[model samples]
Target: MENLESENTPNPRNPKKPKVVIVMGATGAGKSKLAIDLASYFPIEIINADSMQVYKGLDVLTNKVPLEEQKGVPHHLMGIISPNVEFTSKDFRDSAIQIIDDIISRNRLPVIVGGTNYYIQALVSPFLFDDLIEEMDDCCLKESIGDKELEYKFASGNDNCNVDYQRLKEIDPDAANRIHPNDFRKINQYLGLYARSGLLPSKLFQGQKWGRTDNFKYDCCFVCVDASLHVLDHYVEERVDCMINAGLLHEVYDIYSLNADYTRGLRQAIGVREFEDFLGFYLDKDYNADTERIILSTEDKMSKENLKALLESDNIPHKDLLMESINRLKANTKRLVRRQKRMLNRLQALFGWDLHYVDSTESLLGNSYDSWPRQVVEPSVDLIRSFLHEDNCTVPTKIPNAVASQILDKRDLWTQHVCEPCGNRILRGAYEWEQHKKGRGHRKRMLSLKKSKQYLVDKEAEAVT
Candidate 1:
């Protein structure tokens, strides 16, 4: 570890916090490109913040920047974790912090870039509520639940384990009301927090200064490379198409198994789940000797068209399923783009983090290859340069809005609501609750309940007469 005192020293204005640059955006939004381009201006190392990219395998599915494309710049924490292990946000935060420290130690700028906002959130915020949940999973839960017993019950779903949830409800109904009964992790965490500290987690942890800007560990220059949804949606679809052309199926095929858990590890990526139906059908032994020969013949190529033709000639239903699976992959990737954008907005609006937005819509729509440097990279570089120089001229100071600051505290974002009229469907947050109220199903249920009440009243009066 090469130690460099120059860049590691605290800024004169804010002596406590060191500078770190974070590049964030939606999927297929050129966040990696922008971050890599920054290396020309400043000595920097890139840390992968995207959750999927951290896991090994499925490089095409995760869209990791290839070694040649990385332009000889050092990138850390990408494709290092085992494909089967569940790497939590705390895992990312801890690893990234160590990498960032090393980068700063060497006098290189630490440029953390990815679409995973929670990973970034966990990195920036010193004491996130999610950290408590992670802590419980690590240290606290073992003491409260008994380590080996917890492992057994968590894996087997023992009926007697409801004792922990019931205990949580008894101690803190407010916390218990928010978490679902089956969510053993949170149930145990809340119980662990209460038992360990003798304090209600609902009151103590619900809405602390977790994601606030002032409470962040470092002075961060947040750069979001964003574009219009229409452009991003089109780009995401195109990228998925390109990934398919680039042996994405082959990557997925190598990892496919009959008993593979889709909810865990790299299998949870969008591309993997969408192809389960097709893979299950293709891999089934009952498909006959001819189908098996066709499958074995195309093992090397694994071309989508080749698979489609085999399915079409043998079974038309299987062919349609394959096509639908490919379409689903594209659709799911687009949905991920939208979701990542929404989270970025939430971080800015709710958390009061000063995010410098560089709109790439125009460049993406026009001559992207030529204009990308000007529209996205150059503007992001300027913001970061100003940030490094401690110039407030280009950067706006974050003014914590009192109402917005307290909103999470006053109303827990994780607070759950169950609508009994709507078949006991659970909804989280005020926004989701309001949306459920306006939904047709909820309205119909309420109307039926009202009519039933009126009919019962009429029947009772007739009986009395």
Candidate 2:
């Protein structure tokens, strides 16, 4: 793609930099172990790419790497935000890029490891929010009033708030086909941009060049952890059990007390949601007992005793109830495994990665024929090392200290110049400005504003020719 060079670089060889290695896989796929093993041999820092793990106080629930497990190796992007705060992919991309540059400056290999596919894609893809937002902004301001009317005016002129798939089809047929019709968020993002910018988000991203042309960038290999259906089911069951033993119920209870929004976010989490149900049932039993005791008359002693005796007798069937609970847990675990498998398949297809099925093994070193450690783990590490050393492999171009220092200084200068509204580094082009205004959140904000009288007046003035 496009390469931005430092002015002081007289020779391309012997560049002052190291490669970035990314380790990606599904949840519970042993990514952390592989990352640690690779970091042991190289001057590497692990950057957490998981979305949920970035939040604080979710160490056990999110499976964040413990401080001791870091093995004195630096880890970035973990526990940086409170659980109450919502994090978006753009926020992740900005932080990750800054950290990656810092790591390279220190001559350390940046190894990004996580299961969050969107965050990883944001890092590797040529599409940057800075440019996209700029393009969207310009488009949003320049569109003809007539054009906006044609786009926004549905057959019934009902404002078309749900997103128009047909508009997306006109702009990017491929994207329209890939995105489900019911996926309102993505659909709205594309359609809303098209209505304002007259350009599709997918089309804006197609074939765009990236400044970082490091061979290591494209040379990065993806190794997906695969397992048989039965094995995966068993693995999920064991994992859920471990989570419960780790006090997942208590974690959910703690989160529930924070706020409705916090509870909603936790409920949306995988294992946390199931555990919340368990907690809800437990609380409901206590609530029912309290309600009964409050409503029952103390003078009706015989009736109250009969009711208490009935409940006590019913509660005696503990073993049967425990068996039922176990069965339900097993079933839920199976469902979760199936969902994970589907998500893995979808991400694998999108990224075109090499999937390696690793059999369960006790040790990292075992029989090459049967174990994940021997067959998948070691081979991946070998590939990373080979890519880093190969002469033809694209290492980031080296720059002289003077030129590199100048570029770093320029970056800092522009840091404060970044858009305060979108919180991204400002783009140089008008086209990019237009794209940002049409992005999902911006458009959603605009629509929300249109409902208010004061905002309506401002919007009207802005729309005036």
Candidate 3:
């Protein structure tokens, strides 16, 4: 699959304005396909919301859309991590906002697509890690050490290191019930935050009310791609088969050779454990083979024989085994899809209800006219009207040229910083800016820019200040 450079197209429908289009669905539900299709119609760039697809060397297993399939639509946040690296929903939320802003700045629609519901919700709602961090600070929270420290502090060298579990039960019973006793990471985060801050993390999280319309400017239209369970199962089965055919086993083998821990998030990804089992079984059969001749046989021959034998074997019956596995997978997939659909419905309902609730509250207080629109909207409209004459609406008058110039300059600077190179402003201190400058393409551009008189003067002036 060839990666194509993304071309920017100005959206004439909403000229000089940006919009966000969020595409959400469960895994194997064709989110990427739909996003690509949407991009074909709109001036949009796709931002991945899937947590698993972000890791490098997990394309086939994670079902990441190939570069060729993206149809030259720019995709962000895919393959951003090594298989061995760690990532979180918080990280995704932070990265996605920046990508969305960048896309908007380029006069393109920001299309967020993936099945990771938490990540999507975090983006649409105010419930973010930054908010959690603020809560932690307000409550005077401190970080907790590893399980060992948690055990020592709580139990004071008791035989049972389950003291952390007991403490969680005492502080936040609901969280304790949901969290497994052995889930050290979650238990530690909960217990540590509570112990240091005197406020339960769960309670702090639960207290924050959401579903306010004033949060975002965009007209959000959530489109759910619905499919029957039978159809979804067929899709998953076909996708799994494709992954296997696309050297998924080989990829798993390569990853296994890296000697990374399987318990970590990357290895714990779907299909990794199953593929690892397949590899182990293959190796064990070769180990138990009787003859040196068999051991010396070609890999193709070994694989063919194994495949034939497995296909022919009556032990555990391949049909029944596959049917059973597929049924289980289908059931789980259906449950997840149903949950996602429910979430979407809830969000839509909440949005509608919130609007009604606000209106009702205003009416009840006898301040129906003193709404947010009165305070913010009328002034903005007046400003816009005053700035633009009826016939000569070429430019806004109230908005100063200097301010407009600065805005345009900042936009240009951001574009240059995010673009190929040479036009970047170093003082912005964006991480992507640094990466852009160090890139090979950017370095070549810098070389060309250095030869230009105006570029050299700008560089010299930048350096002098």
Worst 10 residues of 3 by lDDT: 352-361
Candidate 1's residue-wise lDDT over 1-465, tens digit each? 223256456557856566888999888778998988888888889999988999999999899999999998899999999999988888898888898888876778899999989899889888865566556656754576565545544533445547777766887887887887767667766665665445688788555777888898987888988899889888877887788778787887777765566757899888888888787777643334554432344444444446535534766767777778889998988878867876775676566777888888877787657678888878887787777765342755343467556754454455788899887887776756775698777899899999999999999999999
TM-score of 3: 0.58
Q: What residue runs in model 3 are displaced by over 4 Å at the alpha carbon?
A: 1-18, 129-131, 134-163, 180-182, 210-219, 257-263, 285-335, 345-465
- lDDT score at residue 178, model 3, on the 0-100 scale: 54
Local distance difference test, each candidate: 0.77, 0.55, 0.55
- Count of clashing residue pairs in every prediction: 0, 20, 0
Find the candidate with the highest lDDT and give its number.
1
Q: Candidate 3 clashing pairs?
A: none
Cα distance off (Å), candidate 2, residue 340? 5.4
C-alpha positional error of residue 103 in candidate 3 after TM-score superposition, expressed in Å: 0.9
lDDT of 1 at 200: 83
Would you estimate the TM-scores of all the predictions? 0.77, 0.60, 0.58
lDDT tens digits, residue span 313-349, model 2: 5544433443344456567657655555555543333
* Candidate 2 minimal-lDDT segment of 10 residues: 1-10
Which digits, one per residue and each the tens of the lDDT, describe model 3 over residues 39-58?
A: 53466688888878888876
